[model samples]
Target: MTPALDIAHSVSGQPWHWRGGVIDGLSGSFQPDDLVTGLLLSRGCARDEIDAYRTPTIRSFMPDPSIFRDMDQAAERIVAAIRAQEKVTIFGDYDVDGATSAALLIRLLRGLGLDAGYYIPDRLMEGYGPSGEALVKLAEQGSSLIVTVDCGAQAFEALQQAKDAGVDVIVVDHHKCAAELPVAHSLVNPNRLDEEDGAAHGHLAAVGVAFLLGAAIVRRLRDTGYFDSRAEPKLIELLDIVALGTVADVAALHGLNRAFVAQGLKVMAAQRNIGINALLEASRLDRAPIASDLGFRLGPRINAGGRVGKSDLGVRLLTTEDPEEAKAIAAELEHFNEERRAIEAAVTEQALELGKGQDNRSVALVSGKGWHPGVIGIVASRLKEKLHRPAIVIALDADGIGKGSGRSVAGADLGSAVLAAKDTGLLMAGGGHPMAAGLTVAEDKIDALAEFLDARMADDVTRARGERALQLDAVVAPGGVTPALVEALEEGGPYGMGWPAPRIATGPVRVIKADIVGTDHVRAIVAGEDGRSLKTIAFRAADTPVGQAMLSAGTTRKLWVAGRAKIDDWGPRPAAELHLEDAAWAD
Candidate 1:
């Protein structure tokens, strides 16, 4: 069943003027399933075009890594570092992209029996970059080379410092690029300013880039006879970590990122890695790892380490081979998740309270003192949904540093904005992708940054908020949402991030029965004029927008319900049920 918030179908019933196939030679009225997963794909382009996305696979879809701007250089540099047997250090971000990239790197290096270790930046003290202090420390510890995963794209100053200190940096990052490239020794990013591929395959997260690097290293080693007649590590084995990190980082589930998940999920489901097995047990998820498991179950636990606990907890959890140690780390992360949630709630509540009466703006900036710095980004994202604006939330610490995170609406270039702000000397440091970004500012600059964002984003915000039409795929009848339909939908999944679940709109159902179920759940049976009926449930929506609307449904009123339908087995007879997404009173 779909969630209560799922809006299945959006049919602005303008009569179908063209009766025959709109195309010159087609004969059908465009069934999205024939080409796309759900009605959603049909909205963007022709059905035939979307068909390729339905069943994602490794062989059918993998793009050559060399297509990325700096992949070749990145590959050669990584292999050369490995051959030298240098004390290599992988500097990573604290999030899933960072951890998974670190894990993938660790797996690859260990497979070749090299001395490679990774360090993740501390979320609180070091922030999100290759800290100069840490880089100097690594050099002192005999680290001759450092490869940054998931970060360092914007670390021009830090990379300069590392270079001056006699440490080589092979940066493996996928963040948004700036006008001027950083000075890392071997910077490898698809988003490099000079990338000429029309593929524009910069959508991959850091972990995806690392996977490619792993593949490149293996290829190079094999070519050079380094693995001559010797057992070589299957680079594909690291896909599990790659997939988990890519999905967790919320990278677009397209192109190479899709390949990573397709291969990685298989490895994860099979429990190939001992540490991953321990994580699975700790998360208490279904044996098979689905995209949902990564999003809801695993990603959060991994992130908990960076949010309220040690930044290395995630790396520790991912790299440990011992079941006992992995299990212990998993438990600690689980506890940290609880703490993170509490802190997130507290920060969000305060932000919302402070922004109660703001007016007519394209951006919302909220600030709080002493709120946990780690959760501001999530809170900013939450506000973006409610207010439909580019939102930035900041929490100031006693040291007078404002830790801020921002989530942008469609069409806003958040990372660029942060870069611009930094260029103008208003920020201490900040850079990220368009949709998500972070910045560190002096405590006094929050209001100034807000004003700067408001001016820069006014036109874009107004254009987007004025566009509020719901997107629908195709309309379905109660009978159409059968077990067969559910199975068909699964073919396109596991969906998350950029690729969303499909929503089908059903007829204006007459309220046959409706009642509030579980603590805050709403359940009912909605029927059509032909007597066909389907059960529906809306979880955790008792007094919310959809909840209030459902409770008001009566026999006389015909309402359109849009959402994903799932087979519910809780009843004696397993039956189809609509997970109420959104509802509108019929005209």
Candidate 2:
């Protein structure tokens, strides 16, 4: 548990720790400088599992779909609908994960000649999850079956309403579930309390679960000779959206999820899906997107539609076949994204100002009337990042109903706390996974909810904050931070969430020059004792402690910079630069 370096504190006021101990007994075939091997070992891969971890694949990581509690039943029902040509609708949430999950199923059903319709509730009017009214209306609209993805684990009344309306509902979700299950035709969630065999994959996004159902349906069709006259749909092609949702949802990247991204990126590069192709072009990303692009670029654009514009635009863009329609939708989404950015900036500023007074509380909970509920989740994320603690942002309507979203730091279970609050009558509606959650509460009870969360999560927040050391995968000299090193390190990735990209500490060097660049980024040049200069930039840090330290170093003070080494592809020649995260004085 000792700090990676001899120094105990960095300029950011946190220590640096090695991600893992010395890696030994790796295959003899690997050279001493094989960074991928080292990265795998440091990330908890066993020596014998290096080969499997090196190239994660669905064939290697995918489990039996039938092992899930209701997977088979759900798939069978969907296939039966396809056979009977029954009207079907996909009910999804108003986020990237929901959009992608609904789109994946729609595309699959389209390939099977079903042409299933979709429903995404307006964020402002309908809020999160499928309501009883929405479900019963869909049933009354002649739809005989509905599939709710990325939500519905807590829709006790909604499911009951659907049942009473005589329409079957299948829940394909990954949210944490309470012990008392809702009344659905089938509920397929790996995180369900009764899920034993499939619970190992509790990290899957809703799209991941839908992908399993797709496979199961395909398998069932093949067994029943349903594909004897028609060509079976290639389910692998759908991984593109699966990858998009899994990353956008910020699901952990390991095991099956890693394979989904690693392979999905390849499928995306093929540009078979017209909707995705238009999205890539609209985002002005000329090259195939990496994991980061999905989260930062395309995902946000899709989310923008749900946040500020029409909620169905994302599902439409992802499922459309008309090139002109795709182009127009993509362009509209881009505009919405810009509008969303402006609104988010304003809300984030206000939330941060309000959060300034909550340093003593275990959670930073802020609320304001007339704030856009669509942007509360993003604002919560920003607050959590700034405060380094769990944060919740609630937008209260004129009627005193509050729509709240929360983001949690590592080791703090925000979703469970919200669920506990709902059980105790503090929340009217709430449920989510560990990292993020959504809820509804009365404006009058906001203070009580805050106090309940403070008491429940105080110990967890303290322990997580006390262990706030930056983790480094390796240490390299300034000259060693080259394009080759970046390439070597990438063999261990498609990194996101749980499977973190490797970070290296490079320095014991003096700052040669430093200046504020675009927006609030700090760009600097530093030279090691060997006289090799390296480029580094700390994004959105010009006003922060690390940025201030780098700006004041002024070629005299020596320090170590820790960050991910990435190749600067925009340059004439590929060179490496550090996306600096933290720094510590060496002398």
What is the C-alpha lDDT profile of model 1 across 1-587, one tens digit per residue? 22122323333222112111222101213343552434335333246645455555666666677776667777787787777777999899998888888888987898887858889888988788888889989998999889899899888888888989998888888877777887877777877777777137678788877877777778878889988766899877778888888788777777667667877898888788877787788877644777767876899889889989999988888888888899899989989988888888778778877766666667888877888888887789778865667888988989888888899876777887888888888899888887889889998887788888778778877877666445444466665667666655556666666666655667667888889875568998888766788888877567566667778878888877767767674667656788875677664
- Error at 576, model 2, angstroms: 2.0
Each model's C-alpha lDDT? Answer: 0.75, 0.91
* Candidate 1, position 391, lDDT: 87
Which candidate's lDDT is highest?
A: 2
TM-score, each model? Answer: 0.88, 0.96
Across 1-587, the per-residue lDDT of candidate 2 in tens digits comes to 11246547898889888887532211212244467878888888889978888988899999999999999989999999999999999999989999999999999999998999999999999999999999999999999999999999999999999999999999999999999999999999999999999999999999999999999999999999988999999999999999999999999998999999999999999998888899899899877688989998999999999999999999999998899999999999999999998899889889989999999999999999989998999999989988999999999999999999999999999999999999999999999889999999999999999999999999999999999999988777777788777777788888999989988887788999999988789999999887989999999898888999899998888999989988886778889999999998988
Native-referenced Cα lDDT, model 2: 0.91
